[model samples]
Target: MSEYHLDIFMHIPKTGGMTLNEIFKKQYKLSEIYDHDSFQKKMMNMDELTEVEKRNIKAITGHYFYGIHQEFSRPFNYFTMLRDPVDRVISSYYFLRDYPGYEMVKDMTLEEFVVKGPEAPNLQTLMVCGSQEIPDIEIAKENLKTFSVVGVTELFNETLFCLKKEYAWGDIHYTRKNITKNRLAKDEVPSDLINLIKKYNALDIELYDLAKQLLNDKLQSLTEDEQNQLKKFNLEQSL
Candidate 1:
């Protein structure tokens, strides 16, 4: 890995990103990492950071889109986690309904939120493609190709193993964060509501399918010893 290269973690909300962010905290020094929520409170945007500030930082993590690399002059690689569109949308709705600064969605039912919630449709595509207008799957796929790692929430431990190997990271162990308690499982949702979510998130569904294939391909490429190591890691975590 190049010492000068920046590691940009594009954290898609409700995609097991919080857990990964905690792992990132263990990997880099406090001064070397730029956290989105931390800087947003200070009203600082990525583009506003000085050259010195940018150069000193090693990793950037937050609910940011893909185009943040434009702010830096040095080499950079992006890594992000994706989730099943239906589950992600459901988790997001329940989490945000009670979350602060989102009072507008407090009374909306799942169906209502599926139809009208802000940033509800094709969120993954929007984040990956960095498009504020219509989200384009082709653009998202092209951008995903450039990511050093693309992880799926369904295969989270595998994703972490990949990250550990890719970055030579230490202490890959972690506890889950930002979980939505009492949330309904995808199967628990009414069929009609599920279809509505699918209608709104068609692009995300497609993107997620592609991401899963990519992750599987990456896992398949691991050497035999590496596969055994991954199995051992999972077993240790389960114990």
Candidate 2:
């Protein structure tokens, strides 16, 4: 491992990443930060960057996945958050549907979206597996273990506490962003469609399970005082 001062935040879609971005912004200088969406016109291959550009970037974040780690000469620690597979798929579907010019999913019904949308199958697995076409579940799980922290979206407060401990992060504060406005309630979604989503995203479901286990283990390891501190922070964050 190269000795690196950098941190790579793998911002998986609809995984509470937008909220984390607020925390990152407070911690790192604007120039040191590289927001892939705004700063990078397209996802540039790691080889495309000059050494100077790489060195200047203290933190990097995007929807990209596992393989980018190979591009950095300096040592870097990675962290990411995973959400419940079903909810993540639903959120992604609704969010993209509304994006102007991304009309392909806009007209799709929830069932149709789960059945045919581009993001329907194993997205998180494919991302971490570092292949768009053929994802390897074992590889994704192993890659996850290498992260400084792998958090679960449902357990946001505890996840943030783990981040604070693992990376010595300060300002574990955030406000939500990129919310899917007027999303359907859980009771409104049909059971059959939900099953179809589960069947299609089996690999993502497995990967999410691994993330949950990792996060749960971390939380269990904390002292009672630390856990209480995290609760206090979460309360403050809510305000």
Candidate 3:
């Protein structure tokens, strides 16, 4: 039997995924690490960590696209977190531009940045993980097919509720997000890019709706504004 019920946490950047990773590491005896920066290592990360550390590992997350491959020799569960595509794209813009590497783009205005998008300097990582490549929606669904659960960013507590039913994880700690003062980046994503993201990530949208329907009762408990927030998308195109 496996020590952990593995969940992938298909990370949609700036969508509280790291917060999830932090909770997994600090709260659960099992530590889930997100290998965002150095994905080249794969299992070498596990090999290098202390056995005690490895034993505490419950999951590995981040925008690990392509395939699901882990060194752990046991059956495991899979899960990922997703946000509405529009917000997701906007966050990607800021995360890349504000954070490291994207310093090259700091000088460009949002209008300039949107046109330059994906190709914006040092934004390859954000492009690959964000809507630029694999749609955030598709990444979440494809991840869901591989894992037992799909955690909605809009309804994360319930996602954890389901997971904890099996793991008996105690009091999941997390800060609820709302009305933060941070300005949005890539604020007005052009229609062309919006349609492009839809084409690439059709499945992600489907999965998110499916997840919402699956957790309707739990989601209904949210505020009206919070409930509508799920529909926010980077594009006006009909999905």
Off by over 4 Å in 2: 1-3, 37-49
Return the lDDT, model 1, position 150. 94
- lDDT by residue for model 2 (25-87), tens: 666666566776444445555566667877877788888778766766667888899988899
- Over the stretch 152-203, how does candidate 1's per-residue lDDT look in tens digits? 9999999999999999999999888989998999999989889999999999
Give candidate 3's error at residue 160 in angstroms: 3.1
TM-score, per-candidate, Cα-based = 0.96, 0.91, 0.60
User: lDDT for each of the candidates?
Assistant: 0.90, 0.82, 0.52
Candidate ordering by lDDT (highest first): 1, 2, 3
Clash pairs (backbone) in predicted model 3? 31-56, 78-147, 78-148, 86-233, 86-234, 137-204, 138-204
lDDT of 3 by residue, 1-239 (tens): 25555545555555567766655545433244535533234545445666665555666665554243455554566555666555555555665666667786667664455446553322222232344443454454444455555566666666665545445556555654432236554446667666655544455456657656655554456566644443432122123
Deviating ranges (above 4 Å) for candidate 1:
37-43
TM-score of 1: 0.96
Q: How does model 1 fare in lDDT?
A: 0.90
Against the hidden true structure, what lDDT does model 3 obtain? 0.52
At residue 188, give the lDDT of candidate 3.
Answer: 63
